[model samples]
Each structure stands twice: as C-alpha cells, then as structure tokens.
Target: MSQPHLSSEATDPASAALPLRRVLPAFAVDVALAATLSFSTLMLGLFGWAVWRGIQLAQQHGGAPDAHALQAQIGTPPVLFLIVTTLVSTGGTALLLYVWRRRATAAERRESTRRLGKPSTWGWALAAGGVTFLFSSLMSAGGRALGLDLQPSNLDLIREGFARFPVFLTLFAVVLAPLYEELLFRRVLFGRLWRAGWPVLGLVLSSVVFALVHELPGLNGKPADSTLFLILVYAGMGAIFAWVYRRTGTLWAPIAAHILNNAIALAVLQIYGDAPA
Candidate 1:
C-alpha cells in the first residue's frame, strides 16, 4: 500500500478564499492560545519564585519550605505574566516581519505600505458616524418596544478612576485603545477577511468577536443589563468601525472615531451621573 500523503494543497481552496472561515477559527484559536500561554508563563514565573525562595530558605534554615508556604509567599496576580507573554508575542511578530523584509524586494515593501497605509476619506467617517447613530437609535427603539430598560449605567468607578488617573485615562482612551484595538480588529481581523473576499461576513464576525473580547474578565466588567443586548450594541459599533476601516482603507479614521466616541461617553457619564433605572 502506498504511504498516505499530507499536503496544504489537499485543503479546499474555497475554504481558503472565505476569509471569514479563516478569521473565525483563528480568532477562537488565538483566544485559546493566549490563555494557555498566559497560564504557562504565570506558572513558570511562580516556579522561579519558588526556586528563589528555596535558596533563601536554605540560607536561613538549611532546607526548602513546604509547598503550601511557598504558594502563599508567591501568590500574585497573573497580570505581569500576561504582559510578558504579550511582549514576547509582539517581539516575535516584529522579528518575523523584519526577517521577511530582508528578503522582500523594494517594490514589494512599497506595495505592502501602500496597501496598509492608505488614508481614508472624510465621507467614510461621516458614514460611520451615521451608521453608529442609526444603530443606537434602533436598539433604543427596540428596547422601548420590548419594555426593557435601555439606559446607560452610572459609571461611578470609571469616573472616579479617571479623576484619580486623568493622565493615564487619557493615554489609555486616546492612544493605547485606538492603536491596539484598530490594529487587532481592523488591520488584522477585518483586513485579513477582506483580502480573503468575504468582506461582509468578515465585517460582522470580527465585530461580534471584538465586542465579546471587550467583555472578557479583567479588561471590562460583565454587563448588569442583558448581555445579548449589550453584545448587539457593541457588535453594531464594531461594524461601524469595520466599515470605516474598509471604506477608507486606513485605520486612523476608525481609531479617531472610537477615541471620540469613548471620550464623549466618558464625559456624558461624568456630567449626568449615570441614567436612572
């Protein structure tokens, strides 16, 4: 009997053409991979702490302490481990891009930049804003029709936190969030899907995923209101962002819009002191 052959060519080209298929699977996989890698990194850090503690214990009492004692001493948030893992992943991606650049022709580099760095039109921003308003209005109307409360929550924590850390909040809202979120949702997720030719599907799928990611623990708190409704609202917002990115072929417009929207929302919450239930 002939040996079985495994090959990339064996995969369906149609599946490859549908970027949504690739993106959805990759999104799921990435989340799982990130969690696993983060946990592993945290465990490694804890092990290093235990070993260090062993040396300290040996110096004082000639032996390592019990595992229970070590666990108590080394207990710390996994945030540092997550940060380290993110840095490693980012560095690795940069290194890979650098390696690819060394081999790529000048024309290829120019084309790559042309594709990635194109500026979006002002009209695209207007369209995005319009879409956002319409979506928000529709959701509000739906909530009213269903007799569901559709008011913004009192963002007391956010308001207080921002007051305490104005500079940090500004940096996070205006700079960090726009840059990272646009890159992740627009450039990577949406762009990949658009390139694969499932522009509409990719737009919707990426938006939903972006909204869910925002809801994950530590990044943001769980919604007290209906999670489904919140997801729909966020997904709608994500669609607007994706549409802006798609129409303009530039990430800056969507980033600006996102930043502006967030700043406005924050200001509203601070001024009005949250909506009454």
Candidate 2:
C-alpha cells in the first residue's frame, strides 16, 4: 500500500523543512494586515472627530459648545476610533480567515479536527488564561522593582473613555477585540506559520507582534524608564495565548482565554478605579 510512503514522509526530518518563501502571510500578509488595520484606525479617529464635531455644531445652534459636552468629548476620540476600527477590522479579519480556511492543507485540517475532538484541548484555555494573568502580574511587579512605575500609557485616558462610553468600549474590549485579535494573531498568522513548518518560530513571532501592536505609547503613568518592560508584559500574555492555540490546534482556545483576560481587566478597572468622595 501507499501508507508506508506517507508514513515515511511524515517522519522524515527533511520533509518538514519547507522553503522560506512558502510562508506568505507568515512573512508578509501578517505585517500587511497589521499596517492596514493601524492606518484604518487612525483614519477612523479623524473621521469620527469630524462627524462628532458636526453633531455638536448642530446641537449648539452654531454657538460655542457647552462646557460639559466639551469635557465629555475629551474621551470620545479614542473610543470612537476603536469602535470604528473594530467594525473595519472585523471585516478584514473575517476575509483573512476565509482565505486561510479555503487554502488550508489536508494535514492542517486533519490536525485541527483531531485537536477539536479532544476534551482537554479547550479545558486548557482556562489554565492558560490564569497563567497569563500571573505572568502579567509578575511583569508589572518586575517593572515596579526596577523603579519604572510602569503603568500602561494613557491609562487614565482609557478609563475616562470608558466612563464616557462604557457599553461600546466594553463590547469592543471584551468581545470584538479578542475575536479580531485571535483571528489575526492566532488563527491566520499562527496557523499559517504552523502549517508552514515553523510552529515554534511562529509562536514567538506572533506573540511579539501582538504585543507591539497593543503597547500603548506617548503617555505613561510614570516616567522612570522606557517602555521595554511594558512590552515584555504584553508579550507575555500574547505568548500564553499562542501556546493555548498551539495546544488546541483550534482558535477557540486562545480566543476564549483572551476574552476572559480582557473581561477580567475591564471588570477590575470598572470596580477598583477612582471612587467618588
């Protein structure tokens, strides 16, 4: 039978090593998609401000805006920017997913099916989330030990944005974001690299890229040192998610952990943030 040849091909070390050019999105599409999402986010920020300003103008009968409205709108920019980007990125992520699914190799499909059938695959996601949470906490502590203060950049801005628009921002963070991010970082990019015979390399690369994209810049809570440590913290979480994805061979594991992590963060922020006197 032909089974022997198939077994040898699977076992042969040389067969696992493919040409570097084979990893298209792994080397190219991932970066392109990231850049596209960033550009769209920036453009949406400007567009949202323009649209809001027009609405304010109409409400104010062409006079100067009320002080309260102006104050509230202070946080509108970032919130609107993310909300719009969520919508735009959702479509982009979906398209990428479709393309990858259609083009996936038979081996990859079989592996995915096998992983999906395992009961323990998804159960590991909860443990992964807990581990990542500990990792994030450790990174934060380490940053503090190094005298860096190390709060997220624009932490207050994000909080205020949530205060101004809680529902949409919450949905974006806890739901839309995890889905979109998992699709790009774990599903399309990691899966592509996995199928391309660079699973370990893919794990590290996707995690680093994920962290880089989310490292909020330009406004730290304290200014003791650079953002290198913060990047490590974010990267740690990304690595955990990537590990979950790898173990399960399905996007659901990492996606669930991501949502849990974000949901916990959002809840903590809402619950423990500054209280009124």
Q: Give the number of the best model, judged by lDDT.
A: 2
Backbone clashes under 3 angstroms, per model: 0, 0
Compared with the true structure, what per-residue lDDT tens digits does model 1 show for residues 1-277? 2211101111122344654455567645544543465446556766775676567765675566677775676555343343344444433332332232212334433443464444445556655755665576677667657775555332443455467776766556445555556655665556545656677877887787776754442334444454556567778888898877666555556766776666655555568664211
Tens digit of per-residue lDDT, candidate 2, span 119-209: 7976897888767766776667666777775666546655866888888777877787777777667766665666577878877887777
Candidate with top TM-score is: 2
TM-score per candidate, in order?
0.58, 0.73
Model 2 lDDT at residue 139? 69
lDDT of each: 0.55, 0.64
User: Can you tell me which runs of candidate 1 are displaced by over 4 Å?
Assistant: 1-120, 126-134, 137-157, 216-225, 275-277
